[model samples]
Target chain A: EPEVTQTPSHQVTQMGQEVILRCVPISNHLYFYWYRQILGQKVEFLVSFYNNEISEKSEIFDDQFSVERPDGSNFTLKIRSTKLEDSAMYFCASSEIADTQYFGPGTRLTVL
Target chain B: GESVGLHLPTLSVQEGDNSIINCAYSNSASDYFIWYKQESGKGPQFIIDIRSNMDKRQGQRVTVLLNKTVKHLSLQIAATQPGDSAVYFCAETPITDKLIFGTGTRLQVFP
Candidate 1:
């Protein structure tokens, strides 16, 4: 079965630095999403991308956060300035339509 | 805030017994519901899903029950095994399509 894939399984960055998490959703998928889960916390929605534009976002997806599908296959989330609280497991998911969502293994971001 | 939640935070069951994990969602506009299982270090893995039109869906040894009137969802695992130990989460999505996840329930199966 085809699955979503993410790069840099784990990352360590200094506070105030910039970080970008990358993901390649299932090839035929039309909708892609980003989510984060803090340690011992529930996963929270960050943003959703469709047609190379942001369809929706959460409060946590402030100005500091941006998502880009620079290429037809790559979806990237960039944090202009990393805060300690930004450290979490970031997941990328995609669906062909609006129903079932397939998730990637996730990228663990650690900001110190 | 409208969100998906679980009635129990954890459940313990014997290896051969059946286990049920429950979740409650507050959004009436939600048309899609999914059950996911997350291991200690992996991402949420899709187990089963039920659309608003359906009340029940079964997959392998797992079954998903949806009660639209009550806006509740439950996942039942039959013959629970030690490998079933993990955190299970229920997520709901509205027409906008962004998934709102619930606080997961940790299921422990003792052999």
Candidate 2:
């Protein structure tokens, strides 16, 4: 089956530096989303993208965070200034519609 | 506040037995619900889903029950195996198409 793929399975970055996590969603999917899971915490929604724009975002998705579909297949999340609290496993998901989301393996971000 | 949650934080089951994980959702307007399994260091894998219009749905080795009146959902795994060990989560999406996730329940299948 076709699956969502994420690059850089794990990343380590310095605090105050910039980081970008990349994802390639299922080819035919129209809606894309980003979610994060802190250690020992529930997975939280970050943002949703559709029709080439952001549909909704949570408080965690502040000005420091931005998502881009720079190409037909790539969805990228960039953090302007990383913080220790920002370290978590970031998952990218996509669906033909919003009801059933298929997730990628996830990218583990570690900021020291 | 979280829109969905589990009744138990952890459950242990013997191999060959059946495992039932329960979740409660607060959104009366939610139209779709999904259960996911996440292993260590991986993402949430889709297990099964049910729409508000249906009371029950079945997949291979799994079943989902939805009760609109009580705002509850549950996943039942038949013939539980050690490979089934993972953290399970339930997510709800209202008509607006935004997903709200629940706190997960860890399942351990003992040999």
Candidate 3:
């Protein structure tokens, strides 16, 4: 089965540094989402992208966070300046419509 | 299939036993519910899903039950094995299609 794929399985960056997490969602899917799971915490939604624009976002998705579909198949999440609390497992998901969302293995971001 | 939860609320079950996990969703507008299993170092894997219009749905060895009145959902695994051990989470999506995940319960199977 086709699955979502993410690059840089793990990322390590210092505090206040910029980080970009990349994901290639299923080719035919139209909607994409970004989620993060802190260690020992529940998965939290960040933002949703569709038609090359952000359709919805959460409070945690503040000024530092931005998502881009620079080109087809690639959905990127950029953090302008990272904080220690930003360290978590960032996941990318996609769906044909608003139905079931398929998830990627996730990229572990470690901010020190 | 043997009975589970012979001990505390640890959610540990014996291999070859059946397991039933329960969840209480928060949204009355949520018409769709999904169950996902996440193992260590990996993302959540889809198990099964049910719509509010349906009371029950089955897939392979898994079954999902939905109770709209109570705002509850449950996942049942028959003949659960050690490989079935993971953190199980229930997610709900309203009209927005944004999935809200629950606090997962760890399923640990004993040999």
Candidate 4:
């Protein structure tokens, strides 16, 4: 079965630095999403992308966060400046339609 | 103020037994619900899903029951095995693409 894949399984960055988490969604999927889970917390939605544009975003998806579908298969989430609280497991998910999204293994972001 | 939450934080079951994980949602507009299993260090894996139009759906060894009146959902795993040990989460969507996940329930299946 085809699955969503993410690069840099684990990332470590200094506070105030930038980090880009990359994901290659299932080839045929059109809707992509980013979610984060703090340790011992529930997963929270960040943003959703469709048609190469942001369809919706949550309050946590502030100016520091941006998502881009630079290519057909590559979808990336960039944090302009990392904060200690921003450290969490970031997951990329995609679906052929608006339902049943498939999730990637996730990228663990650690900011010190 | 919408939230999806699990009723239990952890559950233990013996192998060959059945497991039922419960979830409750405060959003009445949520029309879609999904159950996902996440092993340690891995992402959430799709187990099964049920739409509001339906009350029950089954897939493989799992069955999902949704009660819109009570705004509750449950995932039933039949004949649980040691491999079934994982954290189970129930997510809901209110006509949008983004899923609101629950706190998650850790299932421990022992042999």
Candidate 5:
């Protein structure tokens, strides 16, 4: 079965540095989303993208966070400046319609 | 104040035994519910889903039961195997497609 794929399975960055997490959702899917899981916390929604624009976002997706579908296949989440609390497992998901989002193996972001 | 949560944090079962994981969601408007399994070092994998309009839905060896009156959801696994051991999460989607996930339940299957 086709699945969502993410790059840089694991990343380590210093506080105040910039980071970009990349995802390639299923080719035919129209909607894409980003979620994060703190080490021992529930997975939290970050943002949803459709038609090259953000549909909805959470408080965690503040000024530092931005998502771009630079091309047809790539969805990128960039953090302008990272904070220690920003370290978490970031997952990308996609769906053909609006529901039943399928998730990708997450990218573990570590900030020191 | 509305959230999705599980009654148990961990469950253990023997191979070939049936396992049931239970969840309670507080959002009345949540019509879409899904169960996901996450193995170590991986993301959540979709298992099954149930809409509020239905009471139960089954797939393979898994079944999902929803009780809108009490706002409860449960996932039942038949003939549980070692590979079935993972952290299971229940998620609720109220208005939009944005999913709000619950604290996961870790399942351990012994052979």
Candidate 6:
């Protein structure tokens, strides 16, 4: 079955540095989302993208975070300046319309 | 303040036994619910989902039971195997498609 895929399975960056996590969503899907989970916490929604624009976002998605669909298949989440607390497993998900959202393996971001 | 939550933190089951994971939601407006399985170092994988209009839904060896009145959901796995060991989370979609996930319940299957 087709699945969402992410690049750079693991990312290590210094505090205040910019980091970009990339995802290639399932090809025919129309909606894309980004979520994060702290080491032992529940996954939290970050942002949702559709039609090349942000459709919805959560309070945790602050000024430092931005998402882009630079191409047909590539969706990216960029953090302008990372903080130690930003370290977590970032996941990308895609769905067709209102169907079940399929998740990628996730990219582990380690901010030091 | 409304959120999704699990009833248990961990559950251990013998191989070939049936396993059931329960979840509760405080949001009355939620119209959809999904169950996901997450192994170590991986993202949540879709296991099954149910809509508010349906009371029950079944997949290969999995079944999801939803109770709108009590606002509870449960995932039942038949004849659980070792590969079923993972952290399972229940997510609800209240208004928008963005999912609100619950604290996961770890399922440990042993032979």
Clashing pairs in 4: none
Model 4 chain A lowest lDDT segment of ten: A36-45
Q: Order of all candidates by lDDT, from best down to worst?
A: 5, 6, 4, 2, 1, 3
Show what share of the native A-B interface contacts model 6 retains: 0.89
In the range A51-76, model 1's lDDT, one tens digit per residue, is 97899999999999999999889999
Model 2 has a clash total of 0
The two-chain DockQ for each candidate, comma-separated, is 0.89, 0.87, 0.70, 0.93, 0.94, 0.89
What shift in Å separates residue A5 of candidate 2 from its native position after superposition?
0.6
Of 1 and 4, the candidate ranking higher by TM-score: 4
First chain of candidate 5, TM-score = 0.99
Cα lDDT of model 6 by residue, B19-92, tens digit: 99999999999999999999999999999999999999999999999999999999999999999999999999
lDDT of each: 0.94, 0.94, 0.89, 0.96, 0.96, 0.96
C-alpha lDDT of residue A2 in model 6: 97
lDDT score, residue B109, model 3? 94
RMSD of each: 0.9, 0.9, 4.7, 0.6, 0.6, 0.6
Worst 10 residues of 5 chain B by lDDT: B1-10
Per-residue accuracy of model 5 over B1-111 as CA lDDT, tens digit each: 769999999999999999999999999999899999999999999999999899999999999999999999999999999999999999999899999999999999999
- Give the per-residue lDDT of model 4 (tens digit) for B41-110: 8999999999999999999999999999999999999999999999999999987879999999999998
Runs with alpha carbons beyond 4 Å of true place in candidate 3:
B1-9
> Per-residue lDDT tens digits of candidate 5, residues A1-112?
8999998999999999999999999999999999999998899999999998999999999999999999999999999999999999999999999899999999999999
lDDT of 4 by residue, A2-90 (tens): 99999899999999999999999999999999999998888899999999899999999999999999888899999999999999999
Candidate 3 backbone collisions, by pair: none
- lDDT per residue for candidate 2 within A1-112, as digits (tens), equals 9999998899999999999999999999999999999998999999999999999999999999999999999999999999999999999999997779999999999999
- Candidate 5: the clashing residue pairs are none
Candidate 1 chain B least-lDDT 10 residues: B92-101
